[model samples]
Target: ELGLPLEVAVLGVLESGYDARAMSHKGAGGVWQIMPGTAGHYKLRITDKLDERKDLVKSTRAALLFLRELSKQFNGDWDLVLAAYNGGPNYLRKMLDQHKKKTFWEVSQVPGFKSETLEFVPRFHALLHIMKNPGEYLFKIPEMEQAEVFDVVRFSENISFDLLSKYAGIPLEMMEELNPHLKENEALAQVNFYLPKKFGNLVLKKIRKYYAKLRLEKYRKKTLRVVRYRVRKNDTLLGISKKFNVPRGRIKRYNRLRSAHYLRIGQILKIPIYRSVKSRGRVAKKYRRALSRKGAYRVKTGDTLSRIALRHGTTVARLKKVNRLKSSFVKAGVLLTIPSTAKFQPYRVARGDTLTGLARMFGVSVRAIMRANKLRSRHELAAGKTLLIPDQGS
Candidate 1:
């Protein structure tokens, strides 16, 4: 873990360009993801290559041998070695890694790296770490979408990767990726490459096209939003609410959280603040609506100006006016006037309704409702108290 070792330390920055096998939007081979035929021809036997993929020496030697072949086949130039290594060297039909068709290095230093290859460069070090010490690499690995297709079988050495993929009815591309160490795509020769069948093959087709296009999309990013924060140890819902000046309830609810209990170490919790649906709909949808007098709130104890403001979608100055007060102070029992957290109809709390319960029904959180009405408990949720329940994601 201290220093990426070659067999277990060096990232395939030199071999597979340091990419992970499953997750990266970059659909290229990973640190040890040698192509099936190449792996077999190189004699990198797969006899359960699972943990072996992490074996530093084994993968390193295999990668080195593969690179050597690519070097010789690709005119002794490093570019073809890289291109062949990045995509498939032979896929070009004897074309070298340096084939003028846009090598991996050229794309990186020049074409900005293919979208799938986009993650390759930066992941070199990460691959190195995982290989060196898998335990420490848990968090380092990207949150993969779970290929759900990590198994294999043994067979003869005649079935082509393409042909086996055809028989397995799996995506030829994914079938190849899954059995990287398979030689000549013939997997176990006549036995063929084993796969997860329909779903497995389906995922292969989907990911190949999906992830291949996913490369470098960040470059085309559309929005600069108040990125959501994941909760880590020692972080309180209250503490986060204060820092962002958002009411605690809003923070909890915006994240669609069930209870503070679900708040785990490293849990990704959205900030109380949100951008409008203009954002691919991944986050809560926010829309602008006309204003009304009905939506309002007041200040209370444990009430910081920020939380109150966030709860009602109003600022401190406006909050001051709605109540016709100054200094932003209201006694523990005193209520301060404020607006809705987003555009929406306002209502008073009714009996049989807990803040958490109401928030859940309305897609708002107990914290959001509590903050809107300035309730200290955030969970107590009282009756007959008017509170603004903004439209969900607003």
Candidate 2:
């Protein structure tokens, strides 16, 4: 019955305060503080170009889907849902069983969890109270007779948000407020634009008119139908499939992968969710930013998969292929792409390596290096490789 997106946002505000970059300092980052491993479960790209976790809109969608499952596990109690959302469902399940309290109220009294989770219920109730009749809490949103969220559509190329604001006659500041699914200033750079149900069609028309270069596209939003699996000492695809009511073939397909030997500790997989809502998008030429695929990556010295994927929003697998890598084995200065962006630090000039040689080694132009690094002097190479080698960061 609680199908309203607004109601979901209300809980997210309590979970992450609606900040996409909210990280837990427990190595958690993004509005949801989604750990890298857990995020990988949803196939949320850890690539360099874009951090989907920092993407408020994408992350919120993921969070909502996650909450739906938690609700079922906790038997529809918002209190238990909150606890599970914060502490994870399995942790709560174990505690609930140990406490002998049939309901969330019973589990709240159980010992040994973070204090934030312990205090979650009362806070949620108070917040919900304030939301239903905001006068009590002084929270006011301009009334919109009903709460129907916008439909997200993809664009072909990056467009400035300012242009959209000018067209909509709405303040640029209010764009994200209206569409909580976008990154800050993402409307213009966004290949995907979300518009209110009634208003989306109108906005699409206007966008096509002014931006003739925009092409129509089909878009899909990422969902949160991720599986909850803890890395075992030695679990394989078949092992996990047997544990979670999923088929091995289905898991391989979503991951765009073929190998079962590569999984490591803390690796969580997003089992194909048979019963979750799908995110659909129509593409326009103007929304040209391409979505990345997942892949494997080996660690190189002075290398981090996160940094590699950050530049491209790409995962690690594809990074290796772009670099023509044969295996995960890597040494210092081994260049590899994680899974995300296509940008990376180029090979820096070494003590004896000439700039021209370095460029030739990486199949790039010396002039490009000069321009890329803003180098004015031809003799400015530092003894320890001064050139920044590039990689198609995941």
Q: TM-score winner among the candidates?
A: 2
- Each prediction's TM-score against the native? 0.23, 0.40
Best by lDDT: 2
Clashes of each: 42, 72
Minimum summed lDDT over a 10-residue window in model 1 is located at 283-292
| Model 1 Cα lDDT, one tens digit per residue, 1-394 | 2221234234345454554342234322447665555556655444543423433345557677666666677666554444556666555433313445444454455443355444544455455556557666565434547364444444422445555454445667776555554434444433324466445455345435543344324422432233345455688887766555556765664565677655554344555333333444332212111012234343455877767777756677766654545686666644343444556546666677666656655655665665666677755555876677654444
- The alpha-carbon deviation from the true structure for residue 28 of candidate 1, after best TM-score superposition, in angstroms, is 7.6
Off by over 4 Å in 2: 1-9, 27-38, 54-57, 98-101, 136-142, 147-151, 157-191, 194-394
lDDT of 1 at 182: 47
After superposition on all CA atoms, what RMSD does each candidate show versus the true structure?
A: 23.0, 26.3
Judged by whole-model lDDT over C-alpha atoms, candidate 2 comes out at 0.59
lDDT (Cα, 0-100) at 75 in candidate 1 = 65
